[model samples]
Target: MTARAFPCALGAVLLTLALAGPGRAQTAGPSPTPDHMPKPGMSAPEMADRAAGRFPQPVRVGDLPGRFLLQPEESQPVLGRVTGLVRRDDGGADAIVRLDGVLGLTRLGLQPLAWSGVGARLVAVPVEAVALLGEYVALMGMTPERLRALPTFAPGSATAIPPGETLRIGIVRPFH
Candidate 1:
């Protein structure tokens, strides 16, 4: 088409689209379903929740028989600080923890796992664990504040804990 005609044609198309408005321009299409997609009514979040809850009973970290803790050369001892601890009615406690530094690991080690971060998690610990927080709380070389200074009942606003980072007790059973 001629240059003059081309401009006119483009203008007409733009005008048509503008007049059509967003609603009439395009109708919502059915979401694409992947071959390995979860079953209907079972969303990804729900599936994850179900998988996490599969292991109801909590196991001790030291009880795991095997060489699982075998350190790959890349793995560094990440420091974990206990920011808050709340005692549960069932004798277990909810702990708000903050992980320090990024510890690089192989794909088989830390891939698809968000373990290193500020997280508020439920843990299986005795009520007395609060009193002995210092022994349980380990932060490498840095000297943490007094045990009483840390929030022991609920997460304080100053902590600014992240959401969806709650690690279940069954997975990496809490220490203390």
Candidate 2:
């Protein structure tokens, strides 16, 4: 597959993840894992606070392992929420996300995010919202069955899907 295939593949996966589920209830909080401690800078209690969504920086991709997928034009620093998830039979899962902010290639230029939600299909960020670079996005290629997953809210929140056994699809760009 070519480098551009990444986005197309991820688009299908996002659709799958967005629509997956047996209509389960959204879990309220995260479960604790004693063995998994916070990153070096954070104290134990500080980690706990981060898990509870009390930290100053809510979305820290630095905390996640492995290289995440993003467009070449996309900036290194990004902020977003993993909104949807679906467990695959093979042990892997799919996920949908929303990037709240990002810096475009040129300092003066700003790009908008394209999002496909349950109600809103694939739509680009409105001109008004483009200044914020807020875009609803989707991502895959991570095991959601593991204890500390990439898109989980806390250690073990009800909505949190654990890391799966494998990545069915390699990381690629979204299908435009």
Per-model lDDT: 0.34, 0.31
Top-lDDT candidate index: 1
**Residue-level lDDT tens digits of model 2 in 71-94:** 213342332344444343444333
In model 2, which regions exceed 4 Å deviation? 1-69, 72-85, 88-92, 101-160, 172-176
Q: Report residue 118 deviation for candidate 1 (angstroms).
A: 16
Model 1 per-residue lDDT tens digits across residues 23-98: 7555599755432222344433444454344343433323221211211112323333444444455534444443
The alpha-carbon lDDT assigned to residue 43 of candidate 1 equals 38
User: What RMSD does each model have against the real structure?
Assistant: 17.1, 23.5
> TM-score of model 2 relative to the true fold?
0.20
Using TM-score as the measure, the top candidate is 1
- Any runs in candidate 1 off by more than 4 Å, and if so which? 22-49, 52-122, 125-176
Candidate 1, residue 108: how far the Cα is off, in Å: 32
